[model samples]
Target: MSTAGSPSTVDAPRTAAGSAGSDAPAPPPAPRRRTGGVLWTELRRGVGPWCGGVVVVVCWVAMYSKTPQWQGRWTETTDMLRSVALLLCGPLAVAAGCWQGGRERRRSTGDLLASLARTPLRRALLAVAPAALWPPAGYLVAAAGCTLATWPYAGEGRPFLSHTAADAMALAALGVLGFVAGRLIHWRLTAPLLAAVTYVGLGIPAYSESPARWLSPAYQHTYFWDRPVWWFGPASMVWTAGLAGVALLGLAARRRVVALLPLTVACAAAVVLTHTGDGLWRPDPATARLVCDDGTPQVCVTAVDRKLLPSVSAALSGVNARLRGVPGAPDRWIDGPRTPSPGREQLEAAPGAIVRRVGEPVLLGPREAQLPSPFGLAERGRVSDPVLYANWAVSYLFSRNCPGSGVDTPAARRAAAVNDAVNQWLAPRPYAVPAPLPGDEVHLRRLHGMGPAESRAYLARYLAADLCRPDEVPVP
Candidate 1:
């Protein structure tokens, strides 16, 4: 039945074999695809480089712009970085996650992708990996930048990597939750709504007075002398991971009841970890211990303020010399109290110790100007002008300046008059002479008339009197 050019059956087989052998070596069997290559390609195509870039940029800007305030300590630097991550990066992660989750729906590829052999949960994990990983990676990059920036200025402390790690985990969990939300809802506004809700949720705990505020990750600011417990970071990670797990299960798993187990266990562990009286952090001995100077009438500062030890020591030396033989004279100068307070420096007195906080101004000033003495009458818990002025006079001998006790009572006026007269007698400068109050004339006259010897005797008497008992403080 074949034509002459078509040839017979034996010739047809030979021709087919020749054609098959000649067809580009069968295209090399299509190069055998690998799982890693596919996953990587999916990650690159889905998230895009800009997503990670934006995260890194935001984190860098947030941390670097505020570098001046947080550069003094590793704890402060890391704390600020964590705060920025919560406030800024957390929301960004949510939006990015939502965007990533909606990719299939946006491209109308959901049905096509569903037809693939991979299970839904596995596919979801692969898709969610980029969102979950990039945010934490961005946080770590920012943390590392902050750590490096703080290294030159930071003192006496190591970076708390556990805190940063917990923060990274929390952010990743939030991203996963957002991805799940996007998968379930398929709304365009979900990203912004989730962001708003997250910000509000974080803000509520920060502003609230209840102990339950501890549930918020943003509430974990490190106290000045304290460090978080070892378990606290892990507890936060587990709790957040549980939340993310529950959300993932809701989106990807077939059984909802079984999914709650991880959340329940996580909540229980979080409760147990945070239930201790120490709260999230405890005083760190290394950062809180007294760092003393080498000299008589020992000068000591908390380890965090070791840089100020020299100035504090020099300031206390003159006062200590003046009070060498006096009763009730402080034998030690300590930096503030054992507790932490924000922005306020208090000077306190114990039996033989005088504790005064070294503020920023003092730390930045010259050695001679950093006088943090405990000689003000208010410092001794006395409110009377005469007692205050007498204490001021003793302090003036060491400080060469008015105490400016900020008391405006009649007694204070009289004390000021006496102080001016004494200052005039001692220095004879062209300064404004304060007019003596009616009863203050005698004290002023006596103070103005004292010679060096009489002044020494007067100072001894003033120093010996009990300023705490205002009635017993003798007025010269």
Candidate 2:
């Protein structure tokens, strides 16, 4: 009792511990006690997460590098994402799925898994889940990242959610098909080889003109201003999902006849898409509708170009100054298709003629002049020198659609020189004044000699004169 740490005391404590352990119910088996069970084990330890990480990295890097090309337009942004999903994401998913499918065999666990009481289809489903599902999850994350980047600056339209869903479905199909391929092929390089082959397969149809090209998920789109038909996205989903379902059934079903249902569904979807073709797109009324600026000689642009209205109005200030209240001048400067719409009067000042189609084919109706489409003039939100375009517009108004307009004749040539001189005075080019044409220097000096008011008066007389008829043209 005096020696408190004796062997007898230690043995007493050990005996009590053993008695407590024996009295308590034994701990449940490790499998029963596991947090997420065996499926979690497969997902946690597999390479699937790495594949998803790879997808996000590739998408982010590609998208970041070309931000200017797609950032300000919802259609452009969605298109860019779709392209990446088809070209890069599809291949990556295939490769990752293949690797995952072959992992059990690689680890010599194929025999153990085969001997398990679970059916082959159930075992395969558990194995394929990480491969088939992870890629789509990764794609959604990537799409969200792109959307966040685009929302602040995107103009005039909503995100193409259907297109995004179609692309994700395509990626899942690719992953499932890849897993099937891997389960069948035992070669170590099968995953990478399948990826390369799949890339070529997806690409070949993109450049094709055949309607069958629509069957491929990689098909290109047109017109940032155009919207896809409402059912196009859902139909695309059915097409891709049916294909993936068929693949999965083929790999795991004891009765492969079950695959025919998905196969038939996929065939029907393919047919519908092939027949639909470009009919899938329609002009978006919101984008195609005209938005006008409050300015003298009122500037009008399509709603898609609403943001550019201020800059455009500012750019045209000099031209408006010259043309305002001038006889035969345009009343409304409108931007869109070159061909005039029905019931709309187009003031086409061809040198010898001023063709106007008012309600009664006369000049009395409000004059609507066709302005060049601003789409080509601006790039990545940076507008080019507007003065250059203004110069062209003025010169176009001056040019005569003579029978020999295309040919360079002496009289036509002289008339062109005079026309060029007048254009120069109206809208000065920002840079590189070309060496003067015949009589160009003289005309320029004469115009420069007059006061602004006198010059403006002279310009009016010059425009009213038919430069196509040399006798009708006024001397500067």
Which of the numbered candidates is closest to the native, going by highest TM-score? 2
Model 1, residue 460: C-alpha shift (Å): 6.4
| lDDT score, candidate 2 | 0.77
Candidate 2 least-lDDT 10 residues:
356-365
Note the Cα lDDT for every prediction shown: 0.65, 0.77
User: What lDDT is reached at residue 404 by model 1?
Assistant: 38
Q: Residue-pair clashes per candidate, as listed?
A: 0, 1
lDDT of 1 at 367: 16
Tell me the tens digit of each residue's lDDT in model 1 across 104-128. 8999999998998878887888888
TM-score versus the correct structure, for each prediction = 0.68, 0.74
Best by lDDT: 2
- Candidate 1 off by > 4 Å: 1-28, 45-48, 295-298, 307-332, 340-408, 412-476
